[model samples]
Target: MRIRIRTKWNNQEREVSLEDTVSVLAFNSWRIGMQSLLEIENENFQTDTQMQRIAVLEEMMAFLVHLLDRIAYSSLNDSDREALVSAFAVKLADHVHDNARDFAKGDHRNNFINKLNIRLVDYSETTWANIAQEPGFSMGLTFGNHIADALGPRDKKWVLDYIQQVLMPEMVKLFKQVLARLGLINNEN
Candidate 1:
């Protein structure tokens, strides 16, 4: 989803600044992550309870955070990339906390953030498949493991294939489109 930014600067128009763009990207990431979670739920991915649902959503957010970090790597310097991913993760944490607070116990925001940090570190050790330009085999497997854990025993058989083939590819396509529209990346990337 595209975000509109309203700005006023002495009646002179300027391109959306990087800060504003980062905010918009983070917002869109959260929106997209939520949508993805709903889609997965509809597919009967086993988010039967509120805690289960929140766990799935947290996994989705972590995947998105890592994916966004990878996408920004080619286009942004280290500090800028870190800032963008951090902001995106914070926004995701806020959304998760808002949605999960009543159902779950204790510090959802910090919990999600802390888990996200750990996920980022773990996912970082996995390779990025240059040929496919997406998460490598290990990364996708790891994400599948996370989803499977969140989903419990049911649907475990197909989770890995679905995540590696359907989920990750679709998310990459969506994020790339968003970044391209925002001029952070050209269409080719």
Candidate 2:
């Protein structure tokens, strides 16, 4: 028998099927994968095992909230930034739609997806607004100043270069590894 899992985002309903004997962690991992795509762009973000778990949850929540806001304001003019956000939302929505079973319960499942949907809906608007208003929203200029202050003169340039190049790619790689371990990658079909 198959079980159905339903989630709603931006007032749209998405459903997925499960084998009727899947584990909860498996489902959460898929949900985490759908969430991770929003933050790091690529799945190679680096971190340790524990850090990876936390990052997955954090990034997923952040992305969900962000996407909810973008969907809500879909009528607004599209800036380059908005375009990027829309792309991410489309990708995540697709993933969720494709992998409904990974998040659905095997037995008389209840509450998990419903609770997550509620939380995402309730917090997305405020979270998006706060992130947009953040002082460090800009990349090169704002982050450059932050880098200089954080790294001192002797290593400022090198540190900034590392952050843009090495660190970001490493992080993406690590994220992918975590997703693999969590069984999100192989199940995508």
Candidate 3:
């Protein structure tokens, strides 16, 4: 499927095919989430086990999917938006499940989907719009809270600050560029 996006220059509109874009985004989100995980681990965040690290990665992927959904809201119709996000989530789940099977087993895909569903509910309740066009405080806080909960208690106190202050903003900025480049959203947004 293809979605149309409005551009800044001359207010012209362009199309982006969701077929290839969704797969690329799935991989990119996973890669970036892993990079973030590595950064967090290097910072002495206590993800002591592979399971905990995988959980954190799933949280990051879910957040990216939610952000992408919000960014596409203005451009795509409801059905198209649902299709894009759903497909993205499935692909992300597959990536997570496949990578996690070595240490974690028993329907990791469904587990990821379940967690994503719960997170989606929480995210939906958060204010998508604020005085600034960026993601509202509630969204970031909710995400930070999830990641903090997934990490070890020793570093839990610092995880929220790190996630909200450093990690999320960096991921948002990166995805914003990716989305714009894909014509999923305009640069100005």
Candidate 4:
């Protein structure tokens, strides 16, 4: 069987197809894996824990994508769409932080790096590249500035510091709330 996914990119609706044998869990796992790897390398974030979190977040992200795809294929209201997006962002953040303590010590593999590169190329061919690179490509300038900032400190200390201190905690909190609401995590009395 085939399923259609509708995503709005560049103010247009795009459709993606999924196979029947793919479980929601498997689809999500693959998408999240690809996404997390891309973010880590593109952003130049380090820390084994952060990388691991990225991998896990990839799965969660995939799950959200699956859900969104289903909704888009069907008839979903505006409120529903908004809520799903919000929930997805939150869950994504949490999945990124679930194993922080351990992540700090581990590093990503070469396989992950290669896969991420391929995925990025594929993604760039899609509308996302247009969305990300906008306002006269001002975003590219911002990214360059970030790289420059990292180059300033000895051993790129500033960059590493930001990943650990700023990005990680924020991501964790967002995902935690999302997971709670989705009933992926229990809120016991």
Candidate 5:
């Protein structure tokens, strides 16, 4: 039986047609999108600077979040959770070394000792954890926070209810809420 599922993001409503299995379609869409990323030829090693590497990592994580948004919460089983979590770790391990490339921007020139330092610094199991621990990597953690998905079946109901409700609202209300806390802008405007 085919059914239409409606999802909204950024004030846009999308309707996806399900052919008997919603999870089946979700899995295939994610797989195809990631596969295409791999096919693109990597630029020179020289071009793979720290910023570029972080952007690449963000792209990968963002894709996962997008995938989760599509799939039904009940469909995510223990096996699926394990696979997805491990996928993040494995991808982190693969490209962590890419940061060794010389700085492609700024005045920081490539040096032998700096290159060695990048190699010697062990990233442990969680790069996100490492980033969150330090003040210097604030950008990384802020982005990492948005991209990280730790939701399981237990937390799914409230998230889909409360969090999804927030997304349904207009952006102006959300922007004012953020600004009100910082005291930069006032509601009187």
Candidate 6:
């Protein structure tokens, strides 16, 4: 079987077998449909991962709030407060440190450096003051030391202040950057 194809330029006629003609259309349609499906699946996977990350962040936030309330209203002693702050700091620091790569996102020009720079400063200022003098702090050890210093030997108010002022806000920003990098959220900057 065959069909004719006419060119508008010269009305030149050509013979095309029916199978060949239909094959191109059919293959293209199937390819396009598959591409669309793959795109949707990819989008859904990203959404699911982002949603899970958000849920974990919210849970951590809730834990902080609850801890703050306990510190505020309870009759826990100074040591207890310090311990609470230390525990939370270690956890928070670990979480942030683990996901740092996702937010740091290499040296790309579009990297989240603006927001990430502040967090890095906070991490540095909060953790290591004279790293040169020490010259021995690994990333994990530095985080541990920094978290300890950041929350050390303080009263309940200090604990509350550190969490409310420093920790939570940084976590929020870091996660926001992560989501933005993932294109899960729109970034104005």
TM-score of 3: 0.87
Residue pairs with backbone overlap in model 6: none
lDDT of 3 by residue, 8-98 (tens): 3332354445766787677667777887898898888888889889999999998998898887787889999999999999999999899
Q: Any idea what lDDT model 5 has?
A: 0.31
Indicate the residue-level lDDT of 37 in model 3: 91
Pitting candidate 1 against candidate 3, the one with the higher lDDT is 3
| Residue 182 Cα positional deviation in candidate 3, in Å, after optimal superposition | 1.5
What are the TM-scores, per candidate, against the unseen true structure?
0.83, 0.25, 0.87, 0.29, 0.23, 0.24
Q: Model 1: how far is 171 from its true place, Å?
A: 1.3
- Runs in model 2 deviating more than 4 A are 1-62, 70-113, 121-127, 130-189
Candidate 5 segments whose C-alpha is farther than 4 A from its true place: 1-56, 59-72, 98-189
Worst lDDT window (10 residues) for model 1?
1-10
Task: Give all candidate RMSDs, comma-separated.
Answer: 3.7, 14.5, 6.1, 15.9, 18.2, 25.8
Alpha carbon deviation, residue 94, candidate 6 (Å): 1.2
| lDDT value for model 2 | 0.36
* Backbone clashes, each candidate: 0, 13, 0, 7, 0, 0
| lDDT string, candidate 5, 17-58, tens digits | 222123333333323323322322131112123454344333
Q: How many Å off is the CA of 116 in candidate 3?
A: 0.5
Span of 10 residues, lowest total lDDT, candidate 2: 16-25
Where model 4 places Cα greater than 4 Å from the true spot, the runs are 1-78, 104-136, 143-189
Which candidate should be chosen as best, given lDDT against the real structure? 3
Instruction: Give the per-residue lDDT of model 1 (tens digit) for 110-155.
Output: 9999999889988999989665457888998888888888888888
Error of 3 at 54 (Å): 0.5
The 0-to-1 C-alpha lDDT of every candidate, in the order given, reads: 0.77, 0.36, 0.82, 0.37, 0.31, 0.34
lDDT of candidate 1 at residue 160, scale 0 to 100:
71
lDDT of 1: 0.77
